[model samples]
Target: MRKMHVWDENNLIDISEVDRNKVINPMLVFSIKRDGTKKCRLVARGDQQDLSTYSKDRQQDTINNMALMTVLAVALDHNLIIKQLDISSAYLYADLKEEIYIRAPPHIKQKDKVLRLNKSLYGLKQSGANWQKTIKDYLKGKCELEEMRFWPCVFTKGKFLEIIVCLFVDDIVIAGNNVNTINQFITDLQNRFDTRIVNDGSPNERDAVRYDILGIDVEYKKGVSMKFGMLESLTKKLPLLGVEFKKESRYNIVPGTPNRSLNQDLDIPCDKDYNAKVNWIQRAIGLSNYVAMKYRFDIAYYTNILAQHQLYPSDAVLFETERLLQYLWTTRGKRLVWKRNEKETSELIGLTDASHAKGLKYKSQAGYFCIWNGKKLFARSTRTSYVCESSTQSETYAASECLAISRSINYLLSTLTGKKPDQILLTDNTALINSIKGTKTINLDPDIMI
Candidate 1:
């Protein structure tokens, strides 16, 4: 905060301090890394933002997951070192454009004086957008890094060897072919912002510590691979759903069964306890969906099914939620392994499928999973809102959704790889494929179009 001039106590405004400027108590959250390392950090309780109105566009700053995956794939292909860097008090690094005030922290001796913020502070809605703009300006204007066209959060610089930097809010992951280039980038970051180079231990060392970023614990093996997992996090998270796995419990080999009754369109009678367990069921599905989205794609389809019934959950959904927890417990040890394959190709493959009118409301369920050079890039499944007249239309709708996601992924890969690789989309419906190629005609009903 001192480095950024976040506040000036002496600066006073004529207006009286309002309740909107009130601050909440900060707390510390602790977690264990996948490598059995302990981590802890203090975070402000920023939930008081409803007190003020935010009209600014706040979604355009960060890079998407597909962009991050592209950089990771590029790094893996080039045998480059990937290092994570953190900006200290990232929000405070930018000056606030609006004249805002925040209550002084409890530890300060001056209790009555309100802090007139000179820079952005935590709990302010605009802080993230402001800090992101600040970082972008510094990198592009001062450091001379060129931002990618589609992925604004990704920057590239070249001295002797090209260095690629991917940003996720305040956390940065950098990879380059030359060690000196990587070091110089870090030095530049440190010169501009108070930065900490995390997980700096020698990759070849067995005792080297891994780092945690966005709920995934990442470990790099110098020349071989990068392994990531949410094992330690899931260990602590699943118990909150009232799920406790015993050694005697039978483990399922797959995430969900082929004839998974959870996804079947069955109108199970809502028992008296359904309303009571509604919150618990929603919480479980939310936690499971997070795990699925970030770390495990295997459970994506299963979790999506659970999320559809969140508003009106039944006994069966609750039962399936428990089953999902058991599945998580069984596969907690599984990690997303990105290994160095000499023959690895920059291949973009998309697999999409849909269950026609399988939903209780007769809506088709659609899902797609994508991969880049054997690494899972993105996956999503959803029950379509529109009711389809035929199976081909359902498949077409599913394929279109998959195509949208794949386009973004392809754009990222094209920018990073400098060559747009062929995006091969696989689907089980031959008529849908033929319809896409204009070789077959399929009628689109008015309801389907809607």
Candidate 2:
């Protein structure tokens, strides 16, 4: 889905379980890696699979590719991500040799006059290719050529340095160790794709990166703090939970090394960044959300469920996310400052409660809340309790059954929070608690009762 983004991210991604939206259709996500690899993935519903495909036309792809690559390189050079840029309305930054015509999306009359594209945008084919040719040509004169691998793009220079850019038509990823090389690439890209630069609006360097150094409104999240250590962005190579998610693969071994197969050459494009990932707005007080925990916590909820599937997520499930950005914006200057005897002890305590009636799953809903030192978490479960059976039997059986998840949550919470609290587990039926409490007693059921 190579389309233009229409809504503000703060407007959508941050929204909780329930919210409404005016625009809800397929959106083209144009994410070009800093190196230059582009990816086009659909963001439509499960049923909309019928309407997905890369733009077949050549002209559109050409312009978008160039504009995107040009802008992408600029972003990398300037060290910007999830920032904003406004395009001049109806601007087509393409230099086209052939005239093209189009039928606007259904309902509108086909224009007698063909829309001439001077720039690339949502719809077009060769646009990306043309733009890439334009940028590549401009870069040819400026950047010193080093080394590269195709299919899943990879480029290298000195001993251990490389510039890897993946191109999904125009959504690119550019990664390189040489600051000069990356910067020159950006300059050349802009020379071809006219993008309005907005780095000037960034904040002064005094802001906090992680909230803790100072104080964050949301204590759970800390303000990002900046440190001047050298940085490397090694793309994570997780087991392809769903799709191959081709992006990166093993590097660092000699070409003739025998363990070649041990490290699967990533089917995904290979690219990495050598630049320091400073605070949100380039250099600042904070850092990229804890280098690791970001992805871990993000995948926590889905880990078990997704691991179960093991295979690829239906094409509908390629990971496309901006939540981290939303999270960034929301907690831009926040950090979880851990202080000893800060008057807050990290202790864990818990309580669990269950109901008598659940739904068709024939399960009861059991919920638990954990309080640790200073933090708290609430979680619940239903599905793991009962499989379906006779309604009368299920109702009474479910009523007398208590899900055992509370104990597991209590233990995990204790491990994290450190503050252990007495757990008061509760269930609606007294008989249920007795059964668990008195597991030693055998009360064989002659018949089920409501």
lDDT scores of the candidates, listed in order? 0.71, 0.31
TM-score of each: 0.84, 0.28
How many clashes in each structure?
Answer: 0, 86
Query: How do the residues 1-450 of candidate 1 rate in per-residue lDDT, one tens digit apiece?
Result: 555677664563333555545433444668875558787644445565444445456643787766776676667666666788888778888777664555565555555555666766765677788888889998888778888886679888764226788888898988777787778778988998889977564554583337676677777665567677888788888887777675555545555545555544345456777666778888888888887887688898888887877655655676777777788888887888877657635567778888888785788888888876677778888888799888888888877787777777777766655766567777888787666565436432211111
Task: Assess the local accuracy of residue 62 in candidate 2 as a C-alpha lDDT between 0 and 100.
Answer: 23
As for model 1, its CA RMSD to the true structure in angstroms is: 5.0
TM-score of 2: 0.28
Residue-level lDDT of model 2, residues 158-222, one tens digit each, is: 43323433333333344344556555555655655544332222344553221111111111111
Local distance difference test, candidate 1: 0.71
Off by over 4 Å in 1: 11-56, 109-112, 159-161, 206-211, 256-276, 438-450
Alpha-carbon shift of residue 434 in model 2 (angstroms) = 47
Reference-based TM-score, model 1:
0.84
